[model samples]
Target: MVQGHYESLNRKNDERMNAIPYCDTGEVFEADTIANVWKREDKEWLKRTQSDRSGYEYPRLGESPYINMTDDFRMEKKVICQDIFWSCDGTSFVSVHNDFGIRQYLVPEESNTDKLNRNLLLPFTRFFRNQSIVSCAIDPFYTLYNENSDRLAGDRIVVGGKNFPLQLYSLMDGQCILSYDTMNKINGEYETVYSVKIDVESRVYTGSCRNKVAIYDKSRRDAVWMNQSTKKASKGRQSIISCFEEQPMGGQALSRGSLLCGSYANEMFQVDCRHQRLERLNYTRTVAGGIVQILTSDNGRYVYVVRRNSDAISIYDRRNLQHELNVLRLPFRIHHNSAKLKAYIDTAYGLSMGTPQGTILNWGRDLVEFGGVPSHNSVDDPLITSIPPESEWRTNLSSTIPATVVKNCPGDPELFALSHGGTISLCRFGG
Candidate 1:
């Protein structure tokens, strides 16, 4: 969660109330307009099928000229906003706005990319304004389970500090599912949900404030909270950050299903999600910056992290959970704003793989697949390429180097990067 999540710029005032289903691959269903439903070769429901779909539609990749970020590749913006998340099975996808509502955009797999967009798409479902807002700046966290496709449960979204109350709601019989007069108890009854991140199965949530770290387990309805001491370290992995903007920027689980988080301060933290324990992986503080994103493997094997303020990335293998095994520094001042990453897995080798010892480069919108790895054609920018796919901000860094030394100018690397200003970067890891 480096910050900026996706692409696009137009912010619409229109809101919808519905759940639309889209598939990236029809392997899931023989749907005319279905969602989350498909029977696999094993006869298992790939998901449940809901033929009647709805939402704000977006164009498919290459459907319009706006999608062509580069000549070799092009993907439609799909949705107008990019602060949140999106998931697909190849046929269609569900796009969710923080408070505006959710929309389903379809993709006729065989349909030409040049003919896709909002008009070409249809709304399968929509969530109304009472439960949602036309523009309340809702930071919805999304996840898809083994059973259901991706969805915006509204279970965990970052609402500001305690000054602003968070109202939790669930839909039932087309009514206020379970709206609660939210309270940010973390800081005093005045706590605000600064940052919220959920695990793969929608089981855990990591929420933060100015200097505290709180983890809530939905399964147990349990939580762990901690904070930092700037004047002096109070000890025991307390806060996610040791400084201000350098405070905890983001936290994510690892490829092995363990937790990893970065702070604007000099810190990166890890915890074991399966056992509901803090693994406290060994992480060394550097001048590089704070951690933005935490990506774990489906089976929880490998972990990838990016530090934006300092232009660095931490690559960790479960074996070295006590501390970072390797650190990556880049050439140009990594354009921390817009970044994305994808990791390839040789699953046949087993889920507990080790070491990212390979010549791996990933780029583009598809989060596509390459040799046993996931990759996509590059977006039209050299700066980003120089920064490294996952989260290397500056260029010209190496594992062989003693340590990153701050200089007044940018270092030279064979690669350049994109100027797109995205605070967040997406990295594919594990499953």
Candidate 2:
């Protein structure tokens, strides 16, 4: 499987490199013209990418789809970054490190040169905590338009780690504005928060060790609801809450959305948030190795499940969770760390995820000719096929260190790759 995937990837890479003529453009990538190539270059791209209704080919993997070691953002002291999140407004991004540090990088809207220099771009604000941080999230209400229209736009974040009580910090002044002390305790010790997520209504959801999940409302002093797997750890069993995700609103009129929690067990739990007292609605079918991360498509049409240490990701029908649509196989095995997967289904059917080997792999469906017969499927149909899928590999991060997370700028063509060795690599799509 690995050899076949590599052969397909190499063939596609060669085709892409040979299709476009090498040229040098001296234009800087400003905020206004993001995710676009030069006018002449775009015409050539359209000529090469023109397909039938099925737009499965990837746009571009950058100038070259390999690691460039000369441009990495390194700090004076080595501190591994556990996770990173881009703000609602594409102006900045935040990173949580193992050294109990939270750093924010302010992306300048305007740059002087065509190429961006990682050295000049540094973290403008710094926040520190006593314990290590495992997961972090930005306030969903923090937006430039919202802040200007309403004075109370959220500028705070909820962060939790290998400690007690999830805390919310003020991004403006670097202060602990609020803390949720409603976390459940087991065996006289609080469970470590493995993952965190906040919904549109600002309700915080956290997954912890021992297959535990807690939901907190800002108005209440305690958790509104909490749950744990029926299978106990006392029987020499070890199953942790690997990840949690919230369903999208999808034009619904509800104040809160349903939540999905994944554990090391075969089944996953779903909680309906419509009732005052949330309860487990149902459990999905048995998944091998359990699910490490759950990703919802932008349109809420499908759900992507990433399994622990599995190279392939399973896709399911959003409305009918029990139905399996297709599987995405990767070129390499995902280590035990369980890298996060980012979905870009808005403009294209593509997914990006990092590997412990420091390579960022992307899977984009390809438009096949179907033996000279043109074929297409409606937008409502699930993206699946019997044949093995194709993938593109780009190792922008360190080859030695494991890659923790790969995030795309909110409205730009740039990508930020975070490595386990406290280094970040910035790669632009057209650069």
lDDT of each: 0.31, 0.53
What does candidate 2 score on TM? 0.69
Q: What is the C-alpha RMSD of each candidate to the true structure, in Å?
A: 17.0, 12.9
Worst 10 contiguous positions by lDDT, candidate 2 = 17-26
**Which regions of candidate 2 are displaced past 4 Å?**
1-78, 109-119, 143-152, 183-191, 229-239, 246-256, 275-288, 337-349, 365-398, 413-420
TM-score, cand. 1? 0.44
Encode model 1's per-residue lDDT on 149-268: one tens digit a residue. 454454333223335443333221122332223355553574544445544444334444444545444333335443322332234333443211111112232233444555544455
Model 1 residue 260 distance off true place after TM-score fit, in angstroms:
2.9
- Residues 43-77, candidate 2: write the lDDT tens digits: 44455457425776633412211123223332123
Clashes of each: 96, 0
User: In model 2, which residue pairs have backbone atoms overlapping below 3 Å?
Assistant: none
